[model samples]
Target: MSKSKRLMELMMTVNRMRKFTVRQLADQFDVSPRTILRDLQELSELGVPLYSEVGPHGGYQVLKERILPPIAFSEEEAVAMFFASHALRHYLFLPFEAESSTALQKFYYYMPGDVRDRIDQMKNRVDFLTHTRQQKAEYLGVLLEASVDQRVVTMQYETKNGYSERTIQPVGIYASNGFWYCPAYCFLRRDFRLFRCDRMQSVANDSTGIEPLDHRHIHLGNWEEHGSEKPVYIRMIVDLSREGVRRCESELWHVPHMDITPDGSGQLNQNVPSSELMYFAKFFIGLGNEATVKEPSELVECMKGILNEIMAKYD
Candidate 1:
């Protein structure tokens, strides 16, 4: 085989084997050990993370972060991939922020000149807008890993009341409106709670020896089915004007329950958690006259109390 072909095959072979001796590769490729060693050296230079050991049991091993084999992409596919990563630029924090940046750099710089030019032109046209929140989710990586590993974590969480330490086993972490949220089972409340990632002051492994909950069945996509809060929900209905419908569409959680009329009027009818009625009150208040609560007396009272407080402030 040509030297290039041999190197490519060697890359794939070592990645698949993960742990193999120089002699093993040499025998498999029908090449001398010295030639295989030279090829391995070149692969290391090419950014393939390789670790070598000289003991009897130790040999060449790929590190935890393995380099993936190259795949050819069509021009259209390349553009799509570039835009997908580019869209994440709106968020200030990402679970894989550094890796995402480096990947985008590699993808852009390595593309053909024409493709790069096309991407440059398209950059001004298309965008994925997010709220661009100021708060940082510094513990996103740790929370994500704990969720995947089913490990319990203790965190100092700040709430409206104050800061407190709690043990939680996260189901998953998701980014919405430029902020990260972790839905986890909170041992303190003995229930599932949606935690704002920025509110977590510090996170660490649970030293209380609390067993982790099996949240494998719960995911961001289906946590609603489990319950907004212990399967308890209060029916909430709201009437919306055309402007309201447009405004509510920007909120991902409210879109599913919004029904629009041909005349641009709409209604939001959904079961919302009773504990969050105050939140709904604030949201509708922000809409001013565009939205009106039609049902749920508690929500109406909550809104009334808030408006009364504002009126009192003026008085």
Candidate 2:
């Protein structure tokens, strides 16, 4: 095999075995012990973090490091990451665009010549669907940095009513529906909240030495789970005749609890906040009478109001 391919195989061996003696690696790669040691030294210089121990059981191992040297990607792998990153550039908006671009540049630069050429050709041939214009901002990165550093920040937030200043202890950054959101504990509100990064006007580090809040209350995966004092039970009845029973059985909507009555009536039970319950109600609006909110009089009223609004639009 060529030296590059041999080196790639050696790296894979080192990663998989965790520790391998020079003799063992030499035997596996069908090379001399001297050559194996040389290869390990080369990888170490390239930032592979391969370390050797001396004794009877001594072998080489890779030390865990936060930042390691880049790995060799096949032509297909390079193109896949490039396309994925390219698609993310549109949705991530501000800070991620520059960051992903820089990372992609580094990836391209380090790729083998043939793979790099193939990626460049693919990039020239592929075109992404252009997105609508968006307001440019940089606070996403700032919030991300603060979250990673576990630092407190004071920022001006724009809410539906108006702008308000807040002191927040940021816990994590998340993305939902093509927008960036920071889940943090707001000192002003004295509760955990999700804030849209695009709506933030200004952010500055506050060195007031505020303790990091417990993140147990933060459910970064689902925003609906946060900001609720009482869990509201929402039940829905879906007609299998109009809506395919197969789709409901597929669990597309992520309903946690559900039941089917003997008479073929489907019941969905979920403990969600009022806002999330209403948000989900809109999804069944076009189903007409085929979908119905069965419980929580408030949700039934909300769905009725939505149906009324739709009727008004038609009128």
Candidate 3:
């Protein structure tokens, strides 16, 4: 980048931040500390109110009461923003979906007609293939608000057994596997748990105030990252033939235990939750004879039982 462009961005970055270090600036800009020092010197000469403290825990800070002016986007930036906004619209259930849409629309309002035309062309070229939920999660917006305000929420939620009431302190809301899930501190369970937004029947905030969710106390983790969720099924291994591996490449990923030989045959060894046994059974059944069970006689028997049931129906 040219020095002028770098200087403008450097001022904007520093103005937008409360505090930053020379090392942080260097890393962010992919330059050396010496270059950052030179840039800082130039910015200082240009009357940017940058102050520094010399200590083990101290860094540079923008002088108090500074709000930077609005930034103008280049044509490339405007086009990229258009593509980004449309691409993210369908795929993930984001907390800031409404704000994001408004921002995207506002970005186009002041744009040059030529730049808007370029972005329109880019929008036509880009497409994201994703699944849309049949049921709308209207409570997601309310849940997001409650989480931000640190309010306790009382909810009637559907569970495996039946609907149950819960008083929860929502920590984070995330979307995975095509569903929006909120990780919260459940007062009933006295632990962190994930509550599916779609499974929420009714939700309302309690008037009582609580400490807002803090990053220092929050630990976001799930079964894929931790081994603490109880193992629900015996470890099962299934060897796949060459053709089977070819057809199941995408399905085999994210299973946690998978191996493949140079010849293309592979083995998938992982624990399946009993709740998903029928789903996995159907998956293996679809693989036909190309898949062979290798261990955990229970899985083999389960497959045989499913097969027997199918045969009985046919007979």
Note each model's CA RMSD in angstroms. Answer: 2.4, 8.5, 9.8
> lDDT of candidate 1 vs native?
0.90
User: Clash number for model 2?
Assistant: 0
TM-score of 2: 0.60
TM-score of 3: 0.60
Which parts of model 2 are misplaced by more than 4 Å? 1-67, 92-95, 109-137, 207-209, 214-230, 237-269, 286-298, 310-315
Off by over 4 Å in 3: 1-69, 72-77, 91-94, 145-151, 160-162, 208-216, 222-279, 286-296
Tens digit per residue, CA lDDT, model 3, 194-221: 7899898888886556454443345344
C-alpha TM-scores of all predictions: 0.90, 0.60, 0.60
Each prediction's total of clashing residue pairs, residues at least 3 apart in sequence or on different chains, is 0, 0, 0
* Greater-lDDT candidate between 1 and 3: 1
Worst 10 residues of 3 by lDDT: 219-228
Top model number, lDDT: 1
lDDT of 1 by residue, 1-315 (tens): 999999988899988999999889999999999999999999999999999998789899999899998898999999999999999988888889999999999999999999999999999999988899999789988999998999999999998899999899998898877779998888888878889999999999899889887778888887766654555589999999999988888864645488889999899999987887888899999999999999899999999999999999999
Candidate lDDT (C-alpha), each: 0.90, 0.70, 0.75
- The candidates, ranked best first by TM-score, are 1, 3, 2
